[model samples]
Target: MTPELVRELIARGEALTLEFKGEERRQLSENDLVETVVCMANRPTQEMGYVLIGVEDDGRVTGARPRDAGGIDPLRIQALIANRTRPSLSCRVWVVELEGKPVLVIEVPRSCKDLCVRVRV
Candidate 1:
């Protein structure tokens, strides 16, 4: 999915969950991300989905353009997803820049193979 698609989802208040850093920022491990995607897919009628790590859940535009935290490479996140997921779930990762903050956008395509996935990280 394109960055625009991810933005649309956020606008609709459908896809993407804002994960914070420090407070509940339980490290973006491969298993943690995978389980999140799985839970999202399992939700009733939630077909394809996206996960964004940054913004808050209350629609508080806290990020997007100016990525503050360092060392969290987008490529590494993608690799974690690709290497840990089972049955090979197709996904798209985009580094969306909004208001100078960089947000990691992970697009998960609800697969037919399995609805439940275990946390990997």
Candidate 2:
């Protein structure tokens, strides 16, 4: 996504199709990330949903934690979401640099099937 779009989304604040996850204090867990994707995919009204990581709940941009030494891996995130969801969710993951910080953006498409978390247990 473009930096302008990211700024627009942040300014709009959280809504049914938008969610902001702050990673200021701690790293955002994978489980939480997957859960957010599932939640957004389930929303029928929106054609697409956005989850912004490294932003505070109050809309402050902090920065996303790198999954490894390389940095935040969009491919890994896409695979994780696909593998963890029951019908698998196809999402576009990318990092948008804003305010000199890296914000991880996950775009979730509307799912025709009811998407649920795939738990091994």
lDDT of 1 by residue, 1-121 (tens): 4656656656776433322221133445555566776665445544556677655575444554332366456666666666676654556767776555566677666556545544444
lDDT of 2 at 57: 86
Error of 2 at 57 (Å): 1.3
* Residue 94 in candidate 2, Cα distance off native in Å: 0.7
Task: Say which candidate scores most in TM-score.
Answer: 2
Cand. 2 TM to true fold: 0.91
Candidates' lDDT values, in order? Answer: 0.56, 0.87
Residue pairs with backbone overlap in model 1: 31-120, 31-121, 64-98, 64-101, 65-98, 65-100, 65-101, 65-102, 66-100, 66-101
Model 1 gets an lDDT of: 0.56
Per-residue error for 69 in candidate 2, Å, reads: 1.6
Which tens-of-lDDT digit does each residue in 25-76 have in candidate 2?
9998898888888888877674578999999989999999888899988999
